[model samples]
Target: MPYSRLKNLWGGTKSLGKLKVIILSHSQQLVEVDELSEACGLEKIDLQGCSSLKSIPHTDQLKNLQLLNLSGCTRIKRTEVEKKIKGLDQEGGLKETKSESMMFSTLAVKLEPGDNTETY
Candidate 1:
């Protein structure tokens, strides 16, 4: 098993306050997953190839999140995450983030070109 990117990253420090990106591809573990929400400046998160990872914590607090990669998290059910994402979108949570511009293009959900956002 490979080293955990997260554990290795914060090993030298007790806290990571402004973490922006975390790429944990193929890491042995993705523990403390909920800690992501604590980082206020979190942007892109890459969990590609983390086959051991099953479910991901809802990250509505990570309003700055731009990209998310769960391609290799075979255990993760997209339907579950879609529901959470939908909830966040409805509350104008994710839409306020900078990555909102890429949400429609990247995710299955689509925001019409001229449609009123309030009703979307």
Candidate 2:
């Protein structure tokens, strides 16, 4: 089911029971980001380059959630992601990983496109 465009499954979904990954890489119009809360078993998610998306709801409740991709989401911010994936670290920041150590110590990675050369 990864990379499948289940546009209607957001609010309609009830459970995913240990589903490890999901991909929504490029979409034309996915405005509501809050409906993802229903999938509590999700571990990784890809919402990269979703232009119409404006915000991501708080996802601290989804404890299994780990990797997140916001590489080209121009409107999203680091603070917004920090606030969403709260409670992962002591100071409430993205966890540091061996491959990519984000600004936070929680299990999160905020991507911003800039001439600075960054991550997702």
Candidate 3:
């Protein structure tokens, strides 16, 4: 859902055992997904433009997650994203291919025109 009014995603999500993708792009007020960790089978979570988001559930418990698109999330630091990816890499949770690494690198370093803030 884009441009949604949600501030958080909590109750009732734990029962989505077969859920694979969640597209909450541009939900500007969204700050958290409290039950995200319970969605073990999720593969993609696209929170692309959620500018007010502060944090997400830790990636360590997301064994089946393949993509987490946090692009344009101005409240999240690039360093934090880098650290999470690094930890996932160390634990073999993400593919170690050059192209995949490059993609994350690009996402982490990308900056908006005239925007020098260090956030992704």
TM-score of each: 0.56, 0.59, 0.65
Q: Which digits, one per residue and each the tens of the lDDT, describe model 3 over residues 1-120?
A: 778989988655358778888989889999887577678777778887787887766555566776677666666654455554313321212222333222222132221223223322
Scored by lDDT, model 3 comes in at: 0.60
Worst 10 residues of 2 by lDDT: 111-120
Q: Whole-model Cα lDDT per candidate?
A: 0.49, 0.54, 0.60
lDDT for position 110 in model 3: 24
Number of backbone clashes in candidate 1: 0
Q: State the lDDT of candidate 1 residue by residue for 4-118, as single tens digits.
A: 6543334433354677887676774664355555675666667666656655655556566656665545555544455434223323222222422212112322223223223
Best of the candidates, lDDT: 3
Model 2 shows how many backbone clashes?
7
Error of 3 at 108 (Å): 5.9
Question: Which pairs, if any, clash in model 1?
Answer: none
How far does residue 114 in candidate 3 sit from its true spot (Å)? 38
Q: Mark the regions of model 3 whose C-alpha exceeds 4 Å error after superposition.
A: 82-120
The CA lDDT at 22 in model 2 is 75
Ranking 1 against 2 by lDDT, winner: 2
